[model samples]
Target: MKLYYTPKSHFARKNRILIDALSLEVELVDAGNVADSTPEIFANNPLMKVPTLVDGHQVIYESDHIAAYLVRKFDPTDSYQVLTNDVNQLNLRAVMNGVMTAEVELIMAERSGINTQHLKRFDKLRATVTQGMNWLENQADLFPQQPSYAGFHLICLWDHLLLYQMFQLKHPHLQQHIEKLSGFDCVVKSTPL
Candidate 1:
């Protein structure tokens, strides 16, 4: 199996961490996203996105789906049950994903200098992230005791936000939670370079 990804992409980092945690041997193809559409990536993923997995004839994209596949296929411990069986963690994961999407959009808009007309939207997006962080802070106790898929996504979310300096969320509890998550080996090994 091979994964087409960029080393710095948090989405790709999620998969890389999972692969390492599972101790699965897979080739990491450094397919940088330099163009609007790279023909090589488009051939495998119509979306021309990173973290595209090629497992024989099967092609998988999207970080969450790829994580699920890894859990079902590679994890003998079934640790993914912590993410799938818990309702609160699932909702927390969804919030993390929402923040991630909004942060990416904000980053793209700022990078492209398209900030004039969408100023309010950008502010709203920032506010949305803050709200999500607040929610996570309040519900930190409900987090899984072990490093599961949801915990991985949460760590990725916090790292991505900090990496781009997009927005700072000032919640001490969440910060502690993040620190705790970062202590995991998968997270330590998956830090974006």
Candidate 2:
């Protein structure tokens, strides 16, 4: 098995979280250094994506998809272990996904420090991020119940957000969000990307 990954990517980190949690073994290949023009990833995924997993003849792409696949393939009992099986799971996953992408864009913009070209994109993403956070705040009940794929990804995203300092997330709702995650401390603390 092979995993195409980039060290600094939250998406890649998500997969690593699952791999570690399930004690899965796979070869990790650096595949996102576009400066070197990684046509192999584009060829494998057709979209030039990272965190693509190749399990023998099967090629699984997308970080979330790969995470689910890993859990199912390696640890069938993993579903309720890190995530809940609620109907609202996808919505929670959406919130986490939004935060992850927003954090990624924000961090990249800060590091690049570009002018009109990059700042404009940052402005748009920032607005979208606020909307996503509002949604998550409104759906705060999504956590604290049971574990689900959404919950797992949400914690993964939250950890990455904290690690990268995406925003001064010490806001009230942010603290509430952390409190909501108290139930899954075992899985969250156990998995290290």
Candidate 3:
């Protein structure tokens, strides 16, 4: 089995954390990205993204899909995955997805050094991310009692916060939410950041 990914990518971090926690051993290979329009990227996935996996004639793309597939295959005995039979875990996945996108958008925007024409949109995105973070912090109880899919999602978001951290300064507010999530040991171990 071969896991093709770049260590520097956030999505790749998700896959890597899962790999670490599940203790799945696979041959590591760096497929880089589709920037130069690599043939393997197009051949494997039209998206030309990192973190693609080659497993037994199966080609997997996207970090979330790859993580789930690897867990299902390598850690089948573990029923406490993020997307499992549990309804709460599924709901957590949904919540996390929203937060994850907000984080990604904010990070990408910040990295560009300017919001430019998208000022209103950037402000809106920042507000939405803050709102989501506030809400999650307020309702920490909604997370499952056990480490599961939602747990992974929260941890993944935390990882993104540290990695991208679009907040330049005066962003101590998000830290409260992050601190709340960090209370979990699983979050510490699973988070790549």
Give the TM-score comparing model 2 with the true structure, all chains together.
0.72
- Backbone clashes, candidate 2: 4
Model 1 RMSD, rounded to 1 decimal = 2.1
Model 1: per-residue lDDT, tens digit, 1-193? 9988877777888888888878889888888653457658633587777778888988888888888877778875776453375678778878888888788778777777786344788888888888888888898777766776766777788888888886776778767767877877778987976
The lDDT per prediction is 0.77, 0.65, 0.63
lDDT of 1: 0.77
Clashing pairs in 3: 82-149
Model 2 spans > 4 angstroms off: 32-36, 41-43, 81-87, 109-113, 116-121, 144-148, 171-193
Candidate 2, residue 25: CA error in Å? Answer: 1.8
Model 1 Cα displacement at 78 (Å)? Answer: 1.5
Cα RMSD to native, each candidate? Answer: 2.1, 4.0, 4.3
Give the Cα RMSD of candidate 3.
4.3
**Best-to-worst lDDT order:** 1, 2, 3
